[model samples]
Target: MIEFVLNGRPQKLDQVDPNLSILEWLRTKMRLTGTKEGCASGDCGACTVIIGTPDQSGKFQHEAVNSCISLIGSLHGKQLITIEAFRQEPGHPVQQTMMEQHGAQCGFCTPGIVMSLVALHASGQPDASSERAILEALSGNLCRCTGYRPIVAAGREALVQAWSPDDETHPAACLVQEKRALEATLSTGVGLSLPDGPRYDAPQTLDELRKLRGRFPEARLIAGGTDLALEITQQLKTLEHMISVERIPELSGCRVEGDELVIGAATTYRRFHRPISDRWPAFDGMLSRLGSLQIRNRGTVGGNIGNASPIGDMPPPLIALGATLVLDGPDGERRLPLEAFFLGYRKTDLQPGEFIHSVRVPMAQPGQRLFIYKVSKRLDDDISAVLGAFQLTLDGNEVVACRLAFGGMAATPARALAAETALCGQPWTEASVARAIAALASDFQPLSDVRASAGYRLQVAGNLLRRALLASDPRHNDEPMLVTDYA
Candidate 1:
């Protein structure tokens, strides 16, 4: 049985299929159809909902998640706030403000827009820069009818009247309760055993998961359903056995140990945003632009690396930062460097029954300059044509060390060893930059695709390296410039 609090009401179910998505459960089963389904694979945000979870500061944090791709089995004992549950008595402050700001047009996308605003408001962060954050939060949501001007204005208005932290519920309390329930259920060996074979089962411990993997060697292991949901919804493929690893507490925390940042396998990208953003301001821009708020809320960093998509946004940074992957199977645990984790396009080094347990990235030393650039047809919510990460260390006038990593340049995200070799000991100058650009051709034979032609990709990849070099030189690119809106 799966039980949860849906919009201030406690609900329980007995005969629910584990493969059922939260969107399907709400729309088809419960008849709460306010959350629309647009671009059902999670790119579009028509199915946005506010999910309340605990933050690092031990406070209730609300964030937007795409319900369309979120499996119902994943919501065991959690609180789910849909469009129908924003407020009971009257319209919420965000909704009222949107109406006041004339934000709705055609009104098809209003529900998602409001849910995203509610999440932003719940964060208790109010600033003029929040306008951009709000826009970024809704980037996955397409509003063809409205120009997005009014919606942005509505977000600003909501910020002015944002709720106090005291008004929010205690998510930690809910977590404790859910944890107890989960423990009791696990003690009873309760699982989603269905008639057509077990498609999904969320074990509570690593031992149980390992045993299940041993019994069914071909079972699919899922952490975040961001990628697997496509197989179920688009491909219409049915797996005989599916196991979710999110419920395992051992695989869901981020901690710093000595000189390494150890991130658990199931840690969501949104959870790492604040700490990472504080440490690396350059990464703040890239991380914020990774995906819409909904996708970020549910997607995990481990899932991103495990999927082994060449166009994934996080791999280039992980590779540049010298991250390592920790994998565990029936034979114990072994660790591998991030560079060796990917074998080819959509392929990895994991053996059968072995899964990635965590990722560890070493702390950056001083005097190391880091830069990442993403070139896509659209600025937000689009796959990259070329994603680049550059890290360099200089001693006096000579390059001491360098790491150049890129995505969309080959079948997998990889470091350009040849280019790095050319740049490492050379003088940090225009001539050295030209030599590094020349080495790129020998390093990668990029292919032509709808996203970009081979020629355009090669040009952009070289220019990105030059731009990174320029951006790293504080004496050249650090000066403040004035900006004005012309009449």
Candidate 2:
């Protein structure tokens, strides 16, 4: 049975459809209609919900996530907080500010906005009133009526206002109790077996996961269910047997061993954010643009690489950094370069009953340079049109080595062999960079899609390389490439 806490109440779920999404369970089964479903595919935030899970520091953490695409089976051993938990009629902090600031015109998107703001406050983070923090917190939410001005104002007001009140059941007090209640439930291990055909199994250890994979080779393995759950919700496909390795202690770890960073497969992007910023600061900007804070909270880096999406954010960086993958199966384990993991679009080198265990990335030497750039129409919560990752080592005025990789340019995120060859022994000059940019065309013939045309993608790839060159050149350190580039 799937046991969880629902708004300070203990709830046990069984005899429910394993394919049922959290949205369906909330709106239909529970008759709690506060959570609305705007875009069932997770684009609109009308169905946003807050889930309480332990953060990287092993403390209870609250995050806002899309409930439309999240499955009921995935809610095991966690706390589900919804809009119904708050009595807005009594002037809850978020609801009061939202109402006073005229944040809700249509009221359809209000619930999500309230929960999103609550999550930001619940994080115990400083400077939640900043414009950047408010924008990031509400990036996934769409309020067409208010035009986001009032909503943003309300978010700031919530942060600026003193939450103290005479009532014990006020929003602040309730939030404090919520965290304590959720932490109390964390000791409960996850294992849900439905009575019907479909079943959900969550293994706590790596050995148990390998055995489960061997026994149920046909079971669909899930890490975060960010993209995979769409198969059930959007495609209407039934996942009869499901196994998740999310809580496996071994797969969720990140450590450094002998000048190399070893990241477990189930490591979430949010957990890896600080480490990457401390170790490889170049990726910090691109990482922030990977997805919204909600998506990053639940989405895993290994999940991104495992899906083999051409536009995935992790592969290009791994390819450029010369990373390797470790896949373990019933027979044994094997290691290979990240480039070789993908054979084609949506195809991988994973054998039957085998899964990626961890990834090894070679740390940057003192003089090595790293660059990653992503291009999209919107800044946040949008897929990439083109993304590039490059690592270069120069010896005085000459290039000692170069490794380049790109996404959204081909069937798989792979290396640019011709581009790398062009810069291998060339001088670190504009002419050498131009030659290398020209070599990129021979490396990829990208397909045109809604995001960009084939010509635009190819040209953008070259322009990105040019930007990297200008940024890396020592002579251009004091100059700004763009007009708004102020430091």
For model 1, residues 417-447, the per-residue Cα lDDT tens digits are 8899999899998899899999999889999
Question: For candidate 2, lDDT tens digit of each residue in 1-487?
Answer: 6777788787987767777889899999998899998977777788889987755455556788889878887787677899998865575678888888888988998998888998887776788888899998998888878559888898898887655424466665544333454454444445555575788877767788999999988888887788888898789898888888887887886899999899999998888877766777777877787777777877887899999999998899889999999999898889999999999999999999998898998888966888888888777777888888888898887889989999999999988899989998998888988999899989999998888889988988888788888887667652221111111
User: Per-prediction TM-score, please?
Assistant: 0.90, 0.93
| Model 1 regions more than 4 Å off | 54-59, 87-89, 126-129, 162-190, 475-487
Best by TM-score: 2
Error of 1 at 169 (Å): 13
